[model samples]
Target chain A: MNRDGARSSIDVLERYSGETYGRALLGVYLAAPTVWLVSMYAGHAAAGFAAFLVIFAFGLAMDLALRRSSVVLYDERYERISRKASDAVFNVYGGGGFVVFVSLIALEFLGYYEMTPRVETLFLAWSAFVLSWGVCYTAFKSRA
Target chain B: MKNRLPELREREGISQAELAEAVDVTRQTINSIERERYDPSLELAFELATYFDATVEDIFLYEADEDGV
Candidate 1:
């Protein structure tokens, strides 16, 4: 066990099959935005689907390249950095989401704007959270 | 949490990547330890000590708290 009762680095490394799930996650991250953009702007299901497939392929290529070249690990340093990033994200998301929520509601009530489907809007909100967290985590991971 | 890892590793003419590989960690983890930005786990400390043929105390040091002093 580790300092915080987490698994030891050796244990973590040994269990990793060199097939980095992080790379797969990075692939998903890359594909999601392209999916979003194509769906929103292209307005054609076939075009959106094509773009999704292509971008996902590109993401997989990038992932394979990274897996082959880099020695990524889920060591203590990663945990520490991830914790800090999560804390920062929470603060940013709470404040920013509140501001946006209030502004949109105010705009809607005042007849300045129209709201879309609630479920889809909530889905977008969740996507924004994921995007913000990925960006912040990567930024802090590199800098720290 | 301060350590003499960099000096010891340098004296042995070892790269961080090499040490990381030996210790089953990422190179960045070793770099972080050297820079005093991260404290290693007891398991890692012991492993590093064993690798360098030294005690943990020889590598890591605990400073007196300034407030207590």
Candidate 2:
């Protein structure tokens, strides 16, 4: 402990603030749409696979950045709090994803929209769902 | 749950950050505890009690229903 009675070293990495994670998530969202569009234009299954790889790389990069920045150490108490916060965000994301997916399928079935069951389209939709969850989680967690 | 973390920290003349460090938590966690936005776990309650040289009951007050139901 220092003069202030605080611990001298942190045992765990700190969680990034909503602002920081939100910005990184935004970058992923933007890049995902562009990749999907390019793949669609190329009209090749290989192009779709490449798009998936690029998006996966972007997600990996964000994870790495978060870990690198959260070098601050914390104890079990802090870890529990962080875990609960993350769990809440993921729960909401899962529910929202399910609802949107069902709604989309229903719209197609009802003839409200023309749906193509193409592999590329499926990949694009999945990517969009993931990015949207990131955006929502960040926005919700960042609220004052 | 209501706690005396803020009052106790003030009496000790330590910042929330300092208290958090002493308790091995983030400053935000301390702030939330003080504000009653979150409750500490049993292990954490004991840690805080040990740090403040007080019993857990002294720092955290629990009240049952007035009717004792």
Model 1 interface RMSD over true interface Cα atoms: 3.8
In candidate 2 the C-alpha lDDT for residue B24 amounts to 63
- Which residue segments of model 2 deviate by more than 4 Å? A1-81, A106-114, A118-144, B64-69
> Largest DockQ belongs to which candidate?
1
Listed in order, the DockQ scores are 0.26, 0.19
lDDT of 1 by residue, A16-125 (tens): 43335555556676776678677867677677777777777776665554444434645667777898997888778766676777788788899997777993487478
Against the true structure, candidate 2 has what lDDT? 0.71
In model 2, what are the clashing residue pairs, if there are any? A10-A73, A11-A73, A12-A73, A12-A74
TM-score of each: 0.53, 0.48
Q: Give model 2's docking category.
A: incorrect
